[model samples]
Target: MINQTGKFIVIEGLEGAGKSSAIALVNDLIEQHTGQAPVCTREPGGTPLAEKIRDLVKIADASDPLSDEAECLLIYAARTQLISNVIKPALAKGQWVLGDRHNLSSLAYQGGGRGLMPLVKAVSDACLAGFTPDLTLYLDIDPKLGLTRAKSRGQLDRIEQQAIDFFERARQTYLQLAQQDDSIIVIDASQSLELVHQAIRSQLLHRLPLLFANK
Candidate 1:
């Protein structure tokens, strides 16, 4: 049964689309209203074991012998752990949980971006067993601009260093997913950080007026 007092909000987007920053802003907003800090986390890591998998994926060198299928499966394994250990328990306790990335990241990044849709869906369906987020905030940004910001940063991780074309494909896939799901809100992230935060706030309020109104 769904909990009456909590909400699950997932923030998704390309690498440089400002997902981390937006999550901070939204958490603050939610706490202001709800009087409790939301549970914030990210995947491929939410538990101790899941975090190990995250490190393997992010820091693995090209010379490592991990196959595409293996990589995808590991991600799902971590996701399964995350849901069992963190998300479900938080909701059971009536605490909102805001995730930096969720299952959609796999659908867009590995499936759409890397052409592994079948693999992504199979793992998601088998392990997830039909769990879904209440709302997904897709921070949309052009690949060129997003990559520019990413490159300006220090050493790039495995997914971060993927070809620019990969991100383009990922962004397009995100849009397609958003179109199909009314719960997904795509916010143009090319604007200033403040503006983007405002947009997120407005969108969240519009979607869950009762929750925001009572807070």
Candidate 2:
């Protein structure tokens, strides 16, 4: 077996941007090189306590609708739980972390969509102790088409049922952040599934030296 080296790879996108498909591709490549599946985690959930926090944020109760500020606080609380309980320990053990989403989601959704960038950034600064993904694969897609795809799968969740403009704003934030960060790579998720996978493969080939450095 190859030597165990830790790395954190995150898959990010608006809903229906094919994040799951992208995650599978990245997971496969890492497994092929390491001979083991990476430790998989999803934001807003991952640990038991975090999962409860996820439900609190993702479910809508009109009788007691959540304020945007409270939602942001709750998300960070859950994120801290996952990061401290799951992600950090795994990395310390030299295991890769294949995360479904991470702090970027809050930056885009709460900060951009909900127009709480200042609050989100402040909370992020407080909770995040300089942890960041080694690489982020951002699958960019049109929110209109992405919503259609998300709807086809099943009923929309609380967040999924947000106004189209909300997703549009979030998309813009994701693109903006990608532009500013070299560690974040943008993939045209609007393409066919195979094409999306091909793009991910090419990027991994170029940037993922850890997997092959010892080969």
Candidate 3:
């Protein structure tokens, strides 16, 4: 339902929520339907400076630990860089942008998990008051199962190494936000990958029929 020629689509979820596969599916669908490959981007990355910021955010250092507020600021700093340098340009060029993670991740992780919603909100408002994704696919999953799956992937990052309770709060916040916003579609990630893809496709076709109507 977005009026812009280029749309911003974001995928959000906790670690091991199968976001990688979801991104692939979304990319394929966008290309197939539009005959144009969407520009893919990931928050805290996509640009050189942003990638460096991503490393800083992910790596754990006992000697110089990152405080909750500092972590939140770092995430926004990286996001601002990505948006200014990559996302905005691609969108202005009439290219659909598929984002691996967007602002929602911060709202969940920094706000809910870290219990710093007020500061997160202030930063978000200052940086991106009017910006929003055209569509957000949120893969919902149990934190314990998500952590187990994440662990199976190899070494965990600093945020991923957090206790289960942290992810639980994040999940709760995701659900609450999804309930309030029609633009966000929640998918049960516990199901098979095929089922999750089906849900995503179904939601896309139903919610944004105009995008694929001619195709």
Residues 1-215, candidate 2: write the lDDT tens digits: 56566888999999999988788889998888778899999988999999999999999999999999999999999999999999999989989899999999999999999999999999999999678898899999999999999999999889999999999999999999999998899999999999999999999888877544632
lDDT of 3: 0.89
**Residue 208 error, candidate 1, Å:** 3.0
Q: Looking at model 2, which ten-residue stretch has the lowest summed lDDT?
A: 206-215
For model 1, the superposed segments whose C-alpha errors exceed 4 Å read 1-4, 210-215
Off by over 4 Å in 3: 1-4, 211-215
Write model 1 residue lDDT over 54-127, tens digit each, in one string.
Answer: 98888867577667777789899999999999999998898999998999999998899889999899889999
Q: TM-score for all predictions?
A: 0.93, 0.96, 0.95
Write candidate 3's Cα lDDT for 61-106 as tens digits: 9999988888899889999998998889988887889999999999
Best model per lDDT: 2
TM-score of 3: 0.95
